[model samples]
Target: MSARNPGTKLDLQWVSKVRVNTQAVLKRAQQIQGLKTPKKQWQAAWLLKAVTCIDLTTLAGDDTPSNVHRLCLKAVQPIRCDLLKSMDMHNKGVTTAAVCVYPARVPDAVKSLKAANSSLPVASVATGFPAGQTPLETRLQEVRLAVSDGAAEIDIVINRTLAITGQWEALYDEICQFRQACGDAHMKTILAIGELGTFTNVYKASLVAMMAGSDFIKTSTGKETVNATYPVAIVMVRAIRDYYLSTDTSTESLLWLALIKEELGDDWLHPHLFRLEILSSDSLQIYHGTSLSYVSH
Candidate 1:
């Protein structure tokens, strides 16, 4: 696994066609066996980690993000600390995953695990998440505070009006400011695709975000109709694949220069760790939400 093994070549001849039929790509993934298991979870993790350049977090309900933040860390702690202990113990540089929080709970989320030595990535949403209508200034302030609170990742929504009206310039500037506010924090721009009302808009907005400097172009806040669908995700992933192809991979390039840092410790993500925060049953709930039956330890 040398970094310079001339990485696998990605053919981009069908980027648009792939984007057009991303639903099919997801269908192909679903056909794979045991996609719900820990071993299979790596696919989803890998997409976010490598291609989309983000750390995935699950936001299930209206529960305050701060509480969910603790809940998330605890949910996967077993799988992370115990399961991946071997890999992480060998190298402390890696981390657990994502904190996945609501905007209001970021401060406490950062404070909650300050003493731990693991990389418990803190993420928050602004720009009027869920509804996405707060003033831009407020969103910036939220970004400022979230960063100040030790948030490693920031997920923000696009302004629905500007998006529909095609105010991409304004939209781009907003994100640029957010990128500035985030400073070194990775930014995952959530399109809330369901609200975009069309796959076309979703595709376009995703491009706009990525072109403007979004570390990751995410599908949704997981609270709306289009939340985290395999189809929409593929669309963005496809677009990114296209964007990446035409662009140079030089070290000085914007896309090349920025790399998303792993915020989850190996043990912090799975099992066989010194402490336990997450359990299998609770994690089943994270992947399955209310659709499945799961019990917490």
Candidate 2:
């Protein structure tokens, strides 16, 4: 999104000093969930914003070039042209934030995007996605390969074992290697908060990822048993804000727009600094519903 986070040396002191008041975090999350959502045109506008920040993803095992091509085309035109015309947003160049797929599917996504004459980015998941159990050298090479295949963004998973076992330095070192492997491509670090044990460890991992140069710190891999929960997201965004205040370097947030608005304010809600990874079908469904509501009213 913004400039790449150059990253800082491992601040063991800061990482160690972090703590989470579980009950307080739970209370804040409940309050946010109880808040009211936008209605009518305002609801449509929010949906539009979400569409632009979506990373349309297809990580299925049966993924093929044809389906990847289809995914790219949908990303290029996420909403119906007629509905956009009704909203007078047809010329706004609205589209999904990016299209994400596995490394083997990067080339397919790149080729399809080019054929469509669209500049949408192709993001690839590397570093033993869903599980960071791979050897160090192998994970690094996986990142390099994805970049070589034209992945504009690389989503790498952190080794949960390191975070759980209090290996902050090791976690930071591994992420730094991934940053180098990314070269010019943006790096989005997945904390996989689900397996990171407690809220405290999740906050620690988020800080370590930012300190190690993650342009964007993400919540889950969509494969985890607990993906992107409100409580976990609250911890991660706080880490993002804390990192910015200390380093003056902004890290993007992938939590919900409403949550970002409440936690980090409106500035962080833009697509450049915020993203939502969603399935193509789910995004399309939401888009369809929002557009119909806007057109009917």
Candidate 3:
């Protein structure tokens, strides 16, 4: 895992200058998705990796502790024991990257993981999740309460009003406050890209979130009509690559970039810097067997 992106000062000029070529993004995404995929054991191995990156989530109006516990159990053993054994991964201690739920359900997830003796982190959606129209003070308090409830990760919703209206500074400041409230817990800033209305806005929001010290810049909240898509992901990862590059200075930066470029192709695409919140298991299965294009991105 690389060091957490300690975000630099917000650069409005850079943010304003950011651009996304939609046609190019679409073409590259298609090319990546069209690549040939692995088969049999190879496919299984990739699916297992997909399982590990999942933020196994359940966010509903009627969620209960029993259901949360069941979700945690599934997170601990995402695949059946026999299936893992067949794949020769039964004793590998495989688990989803984390378990996500409402802020109020954090304790349930923590208790369940503890009872199961599993160390899976509990990720809570806070700051007026799904719809972030609450008062700023209330929203910030929500983050604090979730952290106090034992959430190791906070998935916060950015105020799309600010992004859509071109209020970049307000948006960056708001996210910075949310990041502060997260304290030691990692922050996954949800850009809610679908609602931002343009690829350029999506790209800009991704940069602002990273610049505000977000641990991971996620694509969507799964509440939008359009959730995660390859085109949007490409734009986001490119911004991540740009941010990684910007962190370096002249000669040393060039050396480090070359080293990472060779040693870890698309190294910024890992779970630490990026995450995709999918709506169904079917998409995960498709990503696993058909193409690493979607999975790798």
Candidate 3 structure lDDT? 0.74
**Candidate 1 colliding pairs, count:** 28
RMSD after CA superposition, every candidate: 11.4, 6.6, 6.8
lDDT of each: 0.51, 0.82, 0.74
Off by over 4 Å in 2: 249-255, 280-297
Q: Estimate each model's TM-score.
A: 0.62, 0.92, 0.87
Error of 3 at 179 (Å): 0.6
Backbone Cα, N, C clashes tallied per candidate? 28, 0, 0
Provide the lDDT at 243 for model 3: 72
Give a tens-digit lDDT track for model 1, residues 179-265.
788877767677777787666567667666766667656565556654544445445545555455445453111111111111122
lDDT of 3 at 3: 38
**TM-score of candidate 3 versus the correct structure, residues matched by position:** 0.87
Model 1 spans with C-alpha error above 4 angstroms: 1-76, 80-95, 250-297
> Using alpha carbons, what is the TM-score of model 1?
0.62
Worst 10 residues of 2 by lDDT: 285-294
Error of 2 at 267 (Å): 1.2
Write model 3 residue lDDT over 1-297, tens digit each, in one string.
Answer: 233446779999999997889999898767656555556876666556656767788888888999999999998998999998987889999988788899989999999999999988899999999889999999999999999999998989999999999999999999999989998888888888889999999989888887888877777777778766767767776776677667662201122222223323644223443333433333310010001122222
Ranking by lDDT: 2, 3, 1
